[model samples]
Target: MLDHLIGRPSDNWKRTQIILTLLASTYLLFNGRTYKLPRSLVVTNRILKQYAPWRIALGTWLLLYLTKHTDILLGLDAPDPLRRMYKRSYFRGTWVLTALDAGFFTAMSIKPAWLRHLLSVVFSFYYLVFADAAEDKTRRVRASITVEHMRTSWEKAASNPILSFFSSLMRPSMTLKKVIKVKRPESSERAQLPPVQVHLYYAGNLDDLPDQTSLLLHFPGGGFVSMPPPCHEDAIARWAVQTGNLICSVNYGKSPEYPYPWAVEECYDLYCKIVESNGKVLGYRGDKPLKIALVGDSAGGNLVTAVTLKILTHNQNLLTSSVSSSFVMTSSDTSASIHESQAIPLPAGLIAIYPCLNFDLSCWMSPSQISLMRAESTTSLNGKSISHLLESKDHMRHQSPLSVEPDLERKSLWRRAFGLEANHAKRGTSLEERIKFMPPSMTDLKGANTSMLPSAGFVPRLAMTSRMSFFNDRIIPPGLMRAMAILYLGPHSYPDFDTDYLLSPIVAPSSLLAQFPKLYMMCGEKDPFVDDTVIFAGRIRKAKRENSRKSHHPEGDSESVTVRIMEGMSHAFLQMIPFLPDGDRATKAIGRWAQQILSSDDDTKTSMTKSKSLSNVAAIVTNEKDMIYRRRMGLVDGLYAGINEDSS
Candidate 1:
């Protein structure tokens, strides 16, 4: 009886899902958040509302029953292993998850404050449990250390309600691997300052390594607000194990509390100290020249790029100030000379994993902002502003052909039996507008005029349905994106959105970017920021070419900038290593690359005649031997004209 009810959709469950969706959507609409969502999400909401109640109920039944045979509705074109794992572990009871998602929204609409709070917690816990299960596949040893003199005034207790609220609710599952407290010598200049905590993860203890070891400075992404889970630690530990290197995971302060210059300054200072100490502070012997690399995902990726640029600019400032050309190495003693501390050098390489580079609020504005801008625009439709009239169903009904369908009689009379024509006259005008506004589908374009179509015309239905590539990500929703932008860039430290290269590294000068060491960037094609990564790689390529020409070496510079776009993956996939085969393959490949960079002789002193571009880097990095999953791979050449035909 249970199998019959759950194995296939019942008439009762179908009605329940539709009713729940409608109720939740109504709740969201009234909450003032629907207007702030991405247009794609808003459009989906509008389309759902246009459907007749009974039709929605019947269609739900059909879709649920049909989709049970395959994972198409999941919209994840990942490997079979990933799909099976996601199905069995994360979303085993699909109905339960769906109900929980709906209940989360509906709970907020409840009248009683106490009951509302209680239901919200009950719904959200189950939701996070199911969602987090996909990434909770590994365990590793971990350690935390507090960096002295790094805290800012913004970090005072109760200074930020946003940070405080999230901290209370989201508890990190931390397992202490080992704790070692090494006090700074009283003679050190920074001994009196407050400490900033940093997390350390590795496959083995410090004793397992030799005197010399490479170190990775890692920044995990949490939208610059929340704390990273243990899965991220597991990935770092795996990398440490694979490369036989130590990994230092930074625990920077979250935004709205620390905001803008706080985290950036903190990361930059810690990085410099690590370099100045020459690996001594991180429990290293500092006998041999230590290789350091930067790795960050999402917001952390932004920090990596920003800190690297800071180093380049700092060195430039020092050069202009008439500092010596040669770098002065600081002694391994607890106290180093001021000159030695200032002479910090660049790392061996830096890796960015689906980083958020562009911070222009206008580019990623919410639907409400778009509506307000449109309402204020000069353009008008029938004497009313375009956006103003667009919001009204009566105005749309008069303009849309779907609302005035002349051939409704031609549709089969049997449509009524299937709920297709049951509420034809009663349907909202939003359905008509959605149909009118949506890009021409494949069916609409078949055998039509080809010459009149725009250069960038119809998008494949799959691209739209597969929410993986757009603002539909559950991990980084549009609402959260809005909050992060307002919090991170709202501060005075990042005043100029157009020219803040430190905040948005993609716009940095070519001369400064040319000074960068080897760069390795890997992002999932399904990520919303995939195109931005492509564009940044192209800019680096351009910088290399320009720098080479300026130096009178017509052949390009050999600064290895590798970019690998994994197919059928999403942002921050590295955190799911071991459980995800693709994630594991990508992580191991990165480990090998890091190992090669650290173990090699000083390649900076040697000059190679061969020029290396993104294509060449891809060939070297994602070779047949590496066995990476890349269905589409190419270089992005042009910058101003946007992505070229061969890009990504």
Candidate 2:
């Protein structure tokens, strides 16, 4: 069986090698045109800019063939850092992902739905095996945040050894570690949701914790269906080390099982428990006050924002002497006690990374949506000169001699040959297509004028691009996103929008937003959620401005809202940290933001920084020369400039 699984190479393999050589040379030749350097210098500085789909597809396929299908590249005789650029490990992983992506796109109906169901099964199994193997070697944590309260029938079943046995078989690596477990809530009478488990990570020994350690509640992104992978553990552990904080990552209930409101309820309950007990739930025995921040990415981002809104709504009702029935307390006694205090304390800040703020993703795009989508391209300028392609005179004087291009016409040709030509051809065919959705509930958001949320039967635009468009993003493609939405929201979609902020936090009223603590959001320029994040930030900024004016609060009195857009990045890039340079940069930025917020005095009349217009916002880019090799090997290198990060 082993011999059969790893088959012998044939003439077809040789033919494939020849074809790959020709294609790789073509890519190298294209890169060559950008510089008038000697032929001996094959590898140059301008390698990361290569963006051909064909090249990426082939590179991934060839990598799989060399590494998995055959042992050709695994032998001792195999070239070290083949071509003096691609590191063995990075090269192997990049290509395998590329091949997997190609398969996933096809399976998800990038071409057609003919074999989608069959391919889905095959790809699912393949992906699970690969993920399990990867996690097997990666470092894992032993600390756990066991749920002592809140239980459901599903949770009881999940804890059954017979049921868990099958689950373990499916995920051997994960099960073997026993890194997580769901326990029955001590008081089953108050159970409203499934069992919730959180994972704790600290830089130092738990016994040696600081006097006043900060707490960061994290939600790892998996489109609301999957659990937090091992990769998140490493990042969170690093964050805890850097900030000296106790980080508890939530293992919220998944979709098609627990779905929409369940995850939000779990998160809110866990948060209340932490705050109400003053971090005792997570084993914190510090003498000083506990400062907390909520951080999440993608689906997790949605959860954090929703929980924050839920807290605001709860506080608002408490002030009005009519606690909303939608808000549920961990217990009847706790609920009664909180009514006197009138509010649960808010977190120091919120850090949302590429969150899907809106669930009412319709088939049609609003005029604003289309405009935002088109804003990234220079091609949309209609006969406008591409003068921005050239560096400023001052920049050119300082640039290296080898990097400079003196000939104007040659420079133009080189730029276009690289990627500018494709950007100019707007009329070229795109994979974007119309997708009808269930009627969106307008009630989900209330009392907010200028809400970014779209309602049912909105006026359709003449030339609208679909929200789920290949031109917009490839990492979280249209089909996968649609599947996730349907699974999480159900077939008819979320019906109770007014109370269900988890469905789409973008629709939350500006009044609620104004009361929100300092919010720090980050997303990739190429992310599908970029438009939603930008719109949400704008709404928050506007609300805070109005509230400050009305209350006559000074400029520094209100907390700042910061938005960071990573150039040339896609959704969920957080998982790539310590691998891609940009990932490390993003992680470092998160640590900095957390420290700043946690250390600052809320009553202080000083503000960190004010947000500027989106146009003027500075974006985070990776311009380091050392990253060229990683970029050339298909690693994320922020080369494209679109929307910028804003700090207010």
Candidate 3:
């Protein structure tokens, strides 16, 4: 397993990894993090740095480059040399990466701690840019398709001797059996047929899971495309452990192969299908059923919120039979009477981490502000725009064919993969004129409170002269901000994409928003989407206020929203959990929130179960339709006892 994890390197490569680690560590001892380096190695590294600067620097980079991308030139279908060379590094300790970065600084003879910190920060952030969406189809599909891609390709370790040297220090790709094992752990461990239909992670012993435990139905974030459940195993495991609950991080279908509504519908179908021993859907909690919480991060947050709104909006879309049989909340002849008292299976709570709720700049940001943002220092601080970044020689060499990024001729090869033809605008048409509208029913975007106040809270403090990798503690750089917008909205001008409630929860109806269960939402202070979360939370607050004023049972039905701004953090912080301290902090905070919400559910269940006996009897009488049963209980006689007794 250890050999497999270091990418199953060849006999020679194992020796190389040892050599590189020694060299890198020697460099770190001299120029390492400002900690007290071993005195002897420090003196040795300094002497070497003084004499052989370029030699050491370039050689280290060569080694680093080799370790990072051993299989770089090879096609995705290329055989073993142990699958992907450059991949996620944090699965094991980041020692190799640390050594590589330290060597770069040392070779430059850079001893300044601050500069080195800057370099490291840049290195980590670039992970978001380079690694995030870069390996779209080949590796991404490999994750979803499971072990076959990894297992079939391997023949021997020493395929390319030079590449093999670097391969030993690189992260491992999933093997055929390994992917299936982690992904469907229950199926692997259980002797009997698995009880649940999806991938599940139990906090402890599955048998120890209490009848009242809260189940977190997690939909992971991957820009609605890449990343499957296995990629999120560590973070999910931490959450499950911290919250001490059952978590089901599902493997939903990815996009550009299954776009827009496919992921959405998959998550929603799973939401509708999660069964409890008490005989209720995942989100439906009653007197007898366990509570469930809908949880997601980034694109996943969007999915859970959309699922919530869609059900609240067209709850009739759900069959009534799915709700719990033991406890039906509706008494009036709403859909309940005609539908046999079927109400939507509402999750007890929702936890969204930096959700990208609104893509329609017009709906959420002012036109001038939008223009200013789109035109900001995209090239200065963040380097090139995503479009230009993809055009680079190296980027082009490594890019996936199924990347969601725009392709040649301003065409979207990605859209074509999912059967969406790029809408070619007529020559000379303005961007506004190019947009096609959906029906008003879909586009009017009635309620989630998307109307912008026209005041920009803060645009990032990025300037044209700022270094590409520079950052403050409290803001996103203009370049990263713009690239993310392009990443999510793509290069297309679709007004309807912004207005569709599923794509942008900010456009969901206020009534639908009011129906959301308890919401705990957090955004990083430095995240580009800070304003989005703030604005969306304000909309929810405003909607709750309005709905409360109009409702007779406002206090009982009002939705609760909690907003948090994590200090010194950035967007999609959850993705950083295994690697960054801030990411782990954010994850723990969420676990705390999850614990709170689940505990409250337990309190509600306890109170409901403790309902007085007379009230329970009356509740049964209200639902009784059989005259004989009512008379047997004397409910019918009690109602007309005065007249009947007097006449007798």
Candidate 4:
């Protein structure tokens, strides 16, 4: 069999290589100690274990990309000095996965069909069960936060010597000089959005810029548990410079402590306050009022849409009395002026990237979902003993950067930055719930009479890897994400919006959708929440058509709602800005799209921008096949073409 695959009789070098490969692979697969393995052995095993080029490529990409993605997620979760140490350990530990993938694909590459399936089903069991003895050597801690833990976390963040050491290791060794331009912040000021602190940023030379400016209200996502705008300083800085848009990012009070509705209420109130300010913002003097736009990723996406819905409905009672009683809207102009007023305004456009639009996906049980459920049992994001810390690192990053996250910088940085103690509001207590959902498989993928035995060239095997599924992006399984979404409100926070369509914005009534501003939405096709984004995109159009006849005022052809599903990408793919190639392109696309969305049509500006943005998207999507492996019945591009006059 080995000779058949190798194409000729084995030479001395080939014989020695195969013997060494088998010995090394057998040792790693059956070993009690994993860390002691050599890097050469691991790499060799990964490359030669599977004869099928496609399987090898899929496995290699999966190991590399998932780790990178998770690093971004964990980096945002909480700050810590130990990340580099654990990451180094994790980079070393992916050998087990490499070995496993190589072995599985090696079997599938064999000739006999029944033998292949039998071996696969048997190997699948071993992969999920017996093979998980190697827990992450990168175990920081596995505990919930209390007062003491919080105090210790603050110390860790504040201890300069420790932070410097970690920061040194964590700093980018190479720069994507082309992607990020270092522009000194000309000035920054705080806008009182009540409980929400909006950090307004501008270019260093504000006076030399054009008169009319666009204000971008930005929100960063950390599962709604943690992560503030300042944490995303690089992105905000680049965006402010790239688009020449004055940006204000909110540091909203979070859940667990602040609870549900607080963030959105603050956001809505802040926008109203900006409207009420007249010309009070620091760096001004444009003849016209700033063109207001709303943008957010993840949880921020949810808030962006929620606030927009509240404005559209004009529902004074949408929020609970306890929350909204003190929350007053002080718009000097009335309803008509809301549409026409230059001084006071409704947002010109709304942009959401992978917002958690649907909270009901936890119950979905497709074959892919089942596979994910089984997969999770083997590599739970939680638990010290999880062999796949690198696998879970992506999710762990989102949970917290440090073991305990310090929210207040006064107790943290000193009086100048923030005089107050931090509010360590968390979204949920139970992120470890997925470990229990062991999905039944193979039977679910039945019905096709043919066996999917491999052949010569690389096979199109997108769905089988940890990074992908038949119908979804296999990052965090839908079932697991749903659990996190349920827990996002935390125990102290009341999920009053549980049944309310307003909370899960996609489910909102079509009448409300029709009332929306020119909306631009996006999501990674592999994102578990992708369905939510796609459904919401379609709903906006359908709602507009439904309400147009009844709409006292219908949206004009120019008022656009657009969505882009970046191919070969998953949830939070933009988070990879300046690092991963896809992330870099996605970030650039977002900047160009934002500019085009808010650009004025006076003379050739709008048409020229539209053409430029469309061209930019074409340039970004270099390989269409890699971009979209699987879409929902091909509606990904279909929906974009149907709604707006332009989809750039």
Candidate 5:
């Protein structure tokens, strides 16, 4: 009779049992109230008020039932008729018991003032238990799409309240402005292009330089973020005068605001425009052009090389039709893969400084770690390991460069221009059809078109020569680089290019050296990045030799490439020049290197040669005066400061 009454599979039966049990628990709890209990036993009354017998029983039963029927609870199996009936009974019992516990607790707490005091203790204990369970469930549901909606709603509301307050307080702080001071060169020796508000500085006049020579395109390093400001004008102006070249320093858009492809495309667009406008003014007429090189430092170095590759792959018409030189990129990061390649570009000419690269969410610390961090030290955030976040299989693929396939047609064009057939070249087109359909390999072309494509076997043999080759490069590591290389070199693979193409060469000052005529690299003995630079120099030297052998061109033997290692200098010494005494050995060494690169008489030196000196010079010493001015102008202030000032 008891089993039939209690275990019946009826909804009303379950609800009735829950109500009866709740009433019995309430009566038992109050019955002891009339008899004064000891202080030690007082907690029992509070516990009883917080959790009635019915609630405890119902919760336990539900937990057990879910555990026993885990497959159906987890939606892993079809539910049997009996199981369905049991689940309904369990839900009804749990809901009724929970309502009773909540209602009774609320009512008792609202009654006598003494009861409220006792009930507060009971509620506190229950609150903790409930919070713990809620937190666990929240974590599991964090990845669910539904949670994102809730988060968005909360964020929107939170941001609104602070927005007006911040807006008012930010207005007065916006008075700072980045000043651009123009100091004309000693003479109008360097031609100055009309200032386009965007032009950072003017270097006198351009007409003074010889006609039909090389055009130097300079891209300064600021990690695709900050700029060197007007103080760099002295150095850049000196460079233009000394080299007798038309120099244009690009201030490309920077990231989090202008991220990824935006800066890259802007640089490429600017480059194309410069070549088109200046190629003729510089005296290169018709399809045959004069020497044009690209130069960049640090992040600019990455941009320069990536742009060069893009032009070579996508803008073949510009190369085949015009006369162009090599490229030079200095002290730049070349690792482009998402995984190992996230290493940020070191400051121009400073190897000790590492780039901040990873952007994974999991790289963030867990709640427990956060708590520990808060308790220990505020700076603990810097030491958190992103490796754990990057260890997931999904992250490995997402961060990898080879994960995405290149467009087939674009790949074919690039492969054909480079005089190398992709492994999958024959998959889509037959031999006869390929020969007939595809443009003739650049190897078979003459004159300007000879260098239209990169050297044969260049991509394939890259890893064999330098340990830092795509595969073995220390910053990149061998496994990831090799995997990417295989994918890029494979046939019909989608846009399988290396991210290194986005970084500057380890040896050169700028990626532009590949396109420019004269290029130089200066490394410090104590600098950690020195080894990679040495390896890079060796690779370029070998490539030059191979190209010379293939072409039999005496022009290839010129001193268009130079690599210098300064003794006793360290990374970021360039920025410390003002602090160093007049006779400081490091400062003198940097000045000397700067003078040598800027004053070199190698006519064959490409315009890109300026990158080595520009970056190295910038790193060796930054002008304190300029920094102060920048601060006064508030250009260096936090992000919103400038915006506030502008709005006001």
Candidate 6:
């Protein structure tokens, strides 16, 4: 029965070779421990192993046979051409015999039931190796023909009948509903509208409220690309509820689809609509004015600042008529030149998180500063002159808020060199040229009615009235502050309009500080932006001095700007969950500050007390904790002893 199952043998030598091959293959299969290698190499070796078993079996048989019968093979290796052919034939025959032996042993290792199935699967793969070993020209030709026929048959079946049948059966199912039912709620508890394209989470009543009511406008930040719907929604909602303020969360248009100017326009449009419809009852109850505030994070901060600037610029009449109260802007980067206007008092209290103010300057220029200048010159000039200008201009003006003097000089030179004087510079030269040469001067600017611009001379008085908060992190490093100062005072003249340009020390805190009467600058001790904030605070104080000395306005007073450094806080600590282990300390502080500002009739005294108290307390607490921790750890003892010994 075993003989019948194995079938007939081809020849004596072939049969003997197959037996020996089986023994060798069995030994290797059971005993060999395949070496492991790198992942890529392991895959390559596995493929090689599949062919190796057959090669080894055939090689062993041929070498043994040749060694046993060397004389007969050597006699046949006499004539040059014939001897070479014989050697090739002998090698080919040996490899073929080895492959068959390998396959026989492989079959023997499998269980009887699986043996037939396994052989069928492995036969085609084995045959490919065997065919390559064929020596006779006729045998090689026949093997190639066989392989081609098998491949063609496989292609036909794979392409048509069997494959097609399975594909048809496996096709995905699609069904359509013919009817739909709408359910209505029995009570007023049902959601009136299904989830829509934009979700707005609002707080506070949209109707008339008491005299102490306030309104918060929240704009989410996603670099003008997407909404920070999930992250900011809860905080904004909670703030509105806790403060008893109405919150209008705007879902502004995004980009690169919408682009810059359009998205900004959309924000302004939404704000206008809200004011038009709900302005009267926004922050106040009686005939008195309502206090409206704007708050946002990251890009949302940018939008808030831009909107506030717009309100001050284009819609002052409406703002002034509706409310004699001040507004608040938080975590914003809308000013075109943060450095220049760092000390400018905002209309209301201004608070900034890790604001990206001066940071945009880097993107506006290259390391050499030449590329940025070239880009600017090319973009500014019209006709065929643009291409020529980019190549010709060696000293490129870098756009930075810090370098006011150099920028002014560059602008003067550009106008004179390009023959761009107001008299000669042609109208409709190119949109680029027109924008370049056009002085930012608006004679009767929409928002500039002299009284509207925050009084430049109102330094000390303004500082007393305004509240500002600045938060930063350790990533902004100290050396970066000095680098920024150099850039600000460097030869490159940065434009005050392009807010996207990167500047040193990240954003310019001074620009905003100088304009607003109330200023609050806070940063984490470990934060990189800390050093910059410190330097900025010093600059603000200096500016306050200059303003006091130069101003003729009675409102001017000379007092140093206020600053705070929060312990263990990061860039956007307020947005963080729990805010602190003690429970959102920053938020509570902000709330208290807001309440005080709203209630206080004397802005100067109110702001002065608040700023001084916060700063002094923060410093004392930080110092005491450091001392206590060091003493507990025994670090203070050794240091104190060493100091005493050195003094003795």
Task: Compare candidates 2 and 4 on lDDT and give the better one.
Answer: 2
**Residue-wise C-alpha lDDT for candidate 1, range 371-438, written one tens digit per residue:** 32232222211113222212221222333232211122322335544567545564444433456454
lDDT at residue 25 of model 1 (Cα atoms): 83
Task: Report the Cα lDDT for residue 445, model 1.
Answer: 62
For model 6, how does the per-residue alpha-carbon lDDT over 54-168 read when each residue is reduced to its tens digit?
Answer: 8867977998978966855545332221221112323333343334323433343356644533563365347547543322322323233332222222222122243334433
Better candidate number, 1 or 6, judged by TM-score: 1
Please list the residue runs of candidate 1 whose C-alpha ends up more than 4 Å from where it truly belongs after superposition. 1-193, 208-210, 228-231, 323-341, 362-469, 490-494, 554-559, 604-648
Candidate 1 lDDT: 0.54
Off by over 4 Å in 6: 1-212, 269-287, 312-347, 359-545, 553-563, 578-583, 602-648
How much is 347 displaced in model 4, in angstroms? 0.4
lDDT of each: 0.54, 0.54, 0.50, 0.49, 0.37, 0.38
Better of 1 and 4 by TM-score: 1
Regarding TM-score, does 1 or 5 come out ahead? 1
Question: How close is every model to the real structure, measured as TM-score?
Answer: 0.52, 0.53, 0.47, 0.47, 0.32, 0.35
Worst 10 residues of 6 by lDDT: 460-469
- How well does candidate 5 match the true structure in TM-score terms? 0.32
Q: Candidate 5 at 556: error in angstroms?
A: 6.0
Which RMSD values do the candidates have, in order?
21.1, 23.4, 19.2, 25.7, 27.3, 32.5
Q: Tens digit of lDDT per residue, candidate 2, span 7-69?
A: 974656667778888899998877756456664444533463475768767887997767774
lDDT of 3: 0.50
> Candidate 5 residues 1-648, lDDT tens each?
333667655657767778888899998877856347786668755776788789878987998978876875445664221221112323233223233233223333265755644453354345345643433332333323132222222122112233224333422221112232222222222225222212422233434333434455556554454453232333344444444455556655544345565566666655544444434432334233334445554355456555655554442333322212112122222221112101111111111122111111122233333222222122112111111111111111222222111112223444656787566544433222334443567434323311111233211110111122112111223332233233222343343132334433332322223333334444433233333344344444545555666677654633544555443332333322223231134334333444454344544332322233133223322333244445644754666786888899
Per-residue alpha-carbon lDDT of model 4 for 68-185, expressed as tens digits?
Answer: 6685544443343222322232223232332233234435455576565456445534544443221121011112223222222222212224333543353332111111111111
Clashing pairs in 3: 147-176, 336-341, 447-510, 448-508
* Candidate 3 TM-score versus the reference: 0.47
Task: Please identify model 3 stretches exceeding 4 Å from their true place.
Answer: 1-197, 210-212, 275-287, 316-341, 361-364, 367-495, 552-559, 602-648
Report lDDT (Cα) of residue 398, candidate 1. Answer: 31
